[model samples]
Target: ALQRTPLQHEQSDILEQQARDEKVALEKATDQGQYFVFCDTAPLLTAVYSDFVFGDTSLYPRARELHARYAMTLILEPDLPWVADGLQRDGAHVQKPIHLKIAQELRGMGSLHYRVTGSGEARLACARAAVLAGNTHIAATGWRRTI
Candidate 1:
């Protein structure tokens, strides 16, 4: 059996505590009047690489759980071609699996989600319409339409 080292255990504890604190703070900060709050990477892709590299999967579940619990997720297939800055990214072809992986993760969590696809204003409009329809009972009514 591969037992976790003491340092690994400590690191996991710290990460778990940080996630708990962040959730508490976010819950406290949410205003009753607010319809939504935005998170850039709602379903964080951080663990996709680290788990591949270091076998550290502690980050994935916590991020996924928090994202699903706190927000209505919108995943955009992004109309733009993937361009790497040469410093901060994996190539687009490489990232496809990561994107699909997150979607699969969210789907397994039974999350209500929207896949927004388009360019510029059209994309924004599609997201808006999806959200509105979702919030207004499309989820309940089973009204799936191609946007």
Candidate 2:
């Protein structure tokens, strides 16, 4: 088990508190089923994905372990491609498509319901689409909606 830094511990505490509060709110807001969307800045993915790609292959095992514990839909959006250090050709990062990478990660995860949509109108359209398709939770960058 990795020991969390002070800041990491604090962040975990805050997230735990928020999860509890959201659970209560979700219970009150819906009768049939509840959907919880966790949204945060893309830096979270930048850090984790970068580590998973560039660091030792052991990092992937840790990521899988963490994912199993959470069991929520993960949507990864980064400004660059997740390339391991030795795998990248010169300047390949410049042309890497973030949306494609996100879609790939979603597929690799395999279990959770996941998709990649742009942050603006496309995201809204995707949300509407999910609602129409009967998804209980729609999570995106800085946006959470229940429909």
Whole-model lDDT, model 1: 0.60
- RMSD for all candidates, in order, please: 8.2, 10.2
Q: Write the per-residue lDDT of candidate 2 for residues 1-147, one digit (tens) a residue.
A: 124222332434433444455455656655646444344422223324344344423334434443433334544344335464453223445334544544555467553544445666777676566454434332432343432
Per-candidate TM vs. native? Answer: 0.64, 0.39
RMSD of 2: 10.2
The top-ranked prediction according to TM-score is 1
Candidate 1, residues 36-138, lDDT tens digits: the string is 5555533244544445435678777766655545435787774578876645455676666667876787687776788888888998899998788667764
State how far residue 134 of model 1 sits from its true place (Å).
2.7
After superposition, candidate 2 runs with Cα above 4 Å error = 1-34, 41-48, 51-53, 69-102, 131-147
